[model samples]
Target: MTDQTPLRSGGRAARRAARAKALPDHMRPIRPGMEGGTYKPLTEAGVEAIHRAALTALEEIGLADAPETGVAYLTEAGAVQGDDGRIRFPSALVEDALARANRAVTLFARDPAHDLELSGTRVHYGTAGAAVHLVDVEDNSYRECGVQDLHDAARITDTLDNIHFLQRPMVCRDIPDNREMDLNSIYACCAGTMKHVGVSFTDPDFVANGLELLHMIAGGEDKWRERPFVSNSNCFVVPPMKFATESCRVMEECIKGGMPVLLLSAGMAGATAPSTVAGAIVQAVAECLAGLVYVDAVKPGHPTIFGTWPFGLDLRSGAMTGGSGEQALLTAGCAQMHHFYGLPGGAAGGIADAKMPDMQAGWEQMCSNVMAGLAGLNMVYEAAGMHASLLGFCHESLILGDDLIGQALRCVRGIEVNDETLALDQMREVCLGGPGHYLGTEQTLSRMETDHVYPRLGNRSSPKEWDELGKPELVRNATAKKEEILAQRSRARFDAETDRAIRARFNIHLPA
Candidate 1:
């Protein structure tokens, strides 16, 4: 394929080229209920139902009646104070929010040169890994993962067409300094990658340094400014009570700048609230509404993304087992809560408690991701190759997760009905025959693009062929894919002068 290559052929081909240029391609869904399967989008009635429930929770059931500085602010903002750590919000207050919030927003990824369009039923996935695990050739001993690991993983993830975005700072544990110098972790994690992340909710100094890192990587402040650094308004509950000051300040920053923030607050039923999904969903809503008051206080109608970083404690071991059906249910219900507010929501899905890749890992990862997509979440982070939630990263887990993401995306293709697939005449042309002569037909070949998810992880080989090649399992194959990506990853393209500037900011001298 030389630069001056001649490729087009046939009169029909010429006609196609002309038609394509004159009129861009139109879209048709993949035919709803094609095989007794259907997806339902939220209707006006459904939204109203969720709102009514939320109103009842706030007006009646109430929130944890506790005293916190953040809750004190909410109490000032028309939230009814109650006893035993319970507070209720007026339903009118919530209805007013639905009329004012932005439901869609674009997240700046990489240098804003890489951002994702998040709206509608679209969902994105990625990971934030600390303590490198699976890519290792040794024991639990993590590799010296620093800037190199960040760039390495970023490059691999960027090349994966299946991965929607790379969550910033994937390798924080191996970066030497975790406490004071930690935001350096965010700087390095986001340096050359094309992904979205707020500076990992760092302190002011680290945040400043991380911003400096972004300007250097992106060429200038203007370039960095071109892509808004995403931030979070993480609301913390003082046991069913209110948010923290740190959370409040973050929300102020996000709302003031019109930066997207994920306001997540979790209450455990029985442990934190009642042992009911509806009960918990309402509590989560009230928690986020507290965040909304902060956002509205800073700048009315700020771009806010709803989130749920909830987990239930296993009272026996007192472990936060987030990888459970309870969490999945929370995610689905959380999606509804945000939608009710007419805001983009973020949820943690495709998460697992598995220490390594196994059946448990696959099941947990796939179910969570699919559930989030079905709920039409905007950002679904905590992605693949991550083991035991945040224990470390794994090449195998990443690979399998990538495939799982592809599967979830395929599910969202909805339905397509056109001349190519409707095949009314084609069906009539072949149905009566012993064999449907559709194989290798022109329509069959042309439409396979919209038809399948080409798997790079799971086994698709016959027993004989697999046995001849040493019978590798799915995990083994996934590990090999990660290695392949690593070997083939080349340094990102940057002009020498710009490159020098980037290196110089980091105090590294480059050749003239």
Candidate 2:
């Protein structure tokens, strides 16, 4: 055979031409709110065992340090307050709260098109953390994240298609005042993206201030109440069956203010919680169940997320190992429990124990992301941009993670088994009477975008092509994309009139 006997220029041209056409939104297969739950890491017996253990824990050991309001509400709703001040729940009360919990809740966005209907195992990925430092990929160092970094993170999140929501990912280290820090974080995230935003408050009273700011952004108190787009990611419990008094108070105010609440229970195994994975899940579930009862007692049907985040522990040194296989299984198991209770829920995943966005980070992020998505987590938090096991946040990694999540969502989407997909006719045509190859076929060209995912920074070039291009690095490409998105000069999301009013009232740190 000659060196170049065949000429497939026409086929190559046709493939390129087909890819150039934009696929419609409906046909785009990989998007937000895709159905998951195809993977079940926990067995039926195992789930039941964990559920029973959680109930027993609530009924027996109970949770200590309940705020007065929470104690009163929960006690009135059938919880027993012991002389030691530990509030214990009977299994009936837990079951009743689960019955009254909002199974299908809609997390709204300022732009209605981005609304998230969290029900069942419908999966969505987003950024979430309180990383104080920003991973300076260029300098190979870390620096304290300021208000502008938080805003820029949101803006980048707004532009990413795979990242469905913009959870407040970084703490505004520059804002010194606690109240101002809380308020400014909300303003920065809201001004950055129209996607549904999730934030936390150090003080309960700060929630009211944050609410006032949200009202101004929503045009009025009534409008903000009508469609509360923000959620309070409240860590209600301090692991091992103890309530965080201040955070519980904050959750109560958030619920009273007509805001969604995420009852986050983060337990680190082998330290604050039991070393066994199932035991860790039991503690998380019991704590969140107590939280659910607290919310239901305060206001029945209030939207709450069963945030059972159980982090893995490296027993060797007693540190969090968020990127380990155990972490993936822990998160997936938590998702199964959410499905077991039929409540809207979220779990932690897509985090990297690696300090940088290298090959290790990529594998670690994808392992948990794929597991979380496959297990049908409604909200996959910390799914992007987190590094050093949540100590650092990288803007470049965040941009690159968008591409990673797209592929994970594709796996959660699974496969279709229709007659057309069976492809008997195409097989016959190719083998019996047509060309030996299937490339450039009608089905191949049509399903290019729908059935396949294309990454923005992942290289698919041949070795020779890569050498010809001077070997572009993924981080460098991601940095360029981040710069390109931030360089855009449009801040119309926050109109000048409203922005001036906000700045005049509060110390809005984002510059014009």
Candidate 3:
């Protein structure tokens, strides 16, 4: 036993070295655009019932308060307008729009390597919200989120392998002017990440300037149109069958500018929409289908996402409960509808109602996220850094959520069983002739990186090894990691010439 000690130590060192070497993006254990949809929360009959209900809602209880432009667009597409100023869609019109919808949509990234193909059960997770406050975990306090916080969050997201895209997560509270806020929001997001981005305009007038900024970034209008990396998260409706006039106008401009639009219909369960889960989903589906018709009316086969985001409400306190099991069910059910319609769809997930990234946050974030992935939601927005039921964002939680999503994505990847994975030969060799255990086998060494996903900050150390090193708190380690990433120069920043050109053209609020 004493003579084998040196050999064992050498073998352990070799294994450690092999594990430390990084695998290419395609060879990684889990990655973006992985297929999910294995979990079915809604039966086929349930999906059909919801679809019939949504169509009935559209035909009977039509939406009201469309902007003049939207009214014209919808009317031209075979919708009938009654004296009550409500637009009602005929069943044939809705079917035509659905038929003409762009089914095979690819959300291009500034770097082609990160482009997301949104078809089938492909799943991608990323940050998204309009959180007003930033949660400071150390002091257990919240502060107003600003442009710098948004930029930092994007930079951090750029480094995380599991975060597939970056949407403007927080509002720039410092910029009081709505137009300037909208412009700066686009500028900051583009400067901080090469991944696909999503943003919303406060006013329709701001979209031209926003497109101009994107044009400069893409070198020209044609190039920006060819590969529009950013999408408009347009909440075109005010829930309960009403259109937000200004946001509808913004959606029109964005579509004409050749930008993809996420037709977001976010209805609160007990407040704005119906109280029942199925009823809330029906309202959300009706609203987004209306928006889809509106999009196809403006331009046939335009790139659009069927975004039906219905958030949960805690009845006892009358507050939003983004982290509840009901929220999980709502998102999962929505994914089923998306699948039923065969549209590229998105829904909210991984939001923590907890004030901090504690035990409650972990359970809340994981519960909905895993469900969303399994249900095969195309875009899982707000999958990280959101807290206080979408009222606050935290950098530490975002860092930790990377590991959390890595595991969630692994679940989404599911188990692949093949002859090789069955390991019949390896088991026979080990049990019959070779060593009794398979730990030191060549198969184990070769499959270590391919078959398993190891978390960057998660500790797998035993009690003895944990004691040897000072016991580290997860949040503390996250904070340290966040600082380390931010301290380094941003790999996603624009070139000096482009940065100068943008600053010269727009009122760039973030520090140079």
Q: What is the lDDT of residue 389 in candidate 1?
A: 61
Best by lDDT: 3
lDDT at 126, model 3: 97
Whole-model lDDT per candidate: 0.59, 0.92, 0.94
TM-score of 1: 0.77
The residue-by-residue lDDT of candidate 2 on 1-512, one tens digit each, is 45443446666776788778877778996988999999999999999999999999999999999999888899899999989889999999999888878889999999887999999999999989999999999988999999999999999999999999988889999999999999999998998898999999999988888998999999999999899999999999999899999999999899889999999999999998899899999999999999999999999998889999999999999889999999999999999999999999999999999999999999999999999999999999999999999999999999999999999998999999999999998899898978978986878777878899988789999999999999998999999999999999535268888888889989877785
Q: Considering only N, C-alpha and C atoms within 3 Å, which residue pairs clash in candidate 2?
A: none
**What is the Å distance of residue 440 in model 2 from its true position?**
0.8
Query: How displaced is residue 430 in candidate 1, in Å?
Result: 2.2
Q: Candidate 3's error at 410, in angstroms?
A: 0.8
Candidate 3 or 2, higher TM-score? 3
Error of 1 at 197 (Å): 3.2
Error in Å for residue 355 of model 3: 0.7
Residue-pair clashes per prediction, in order, are 17, 0, 0
Each prediction's RMSD over C-alphas, in Å, is 6.6, 2.6, 1.5
Task: Report the Cα lDDT for candidate 2.
Answer: 0.92
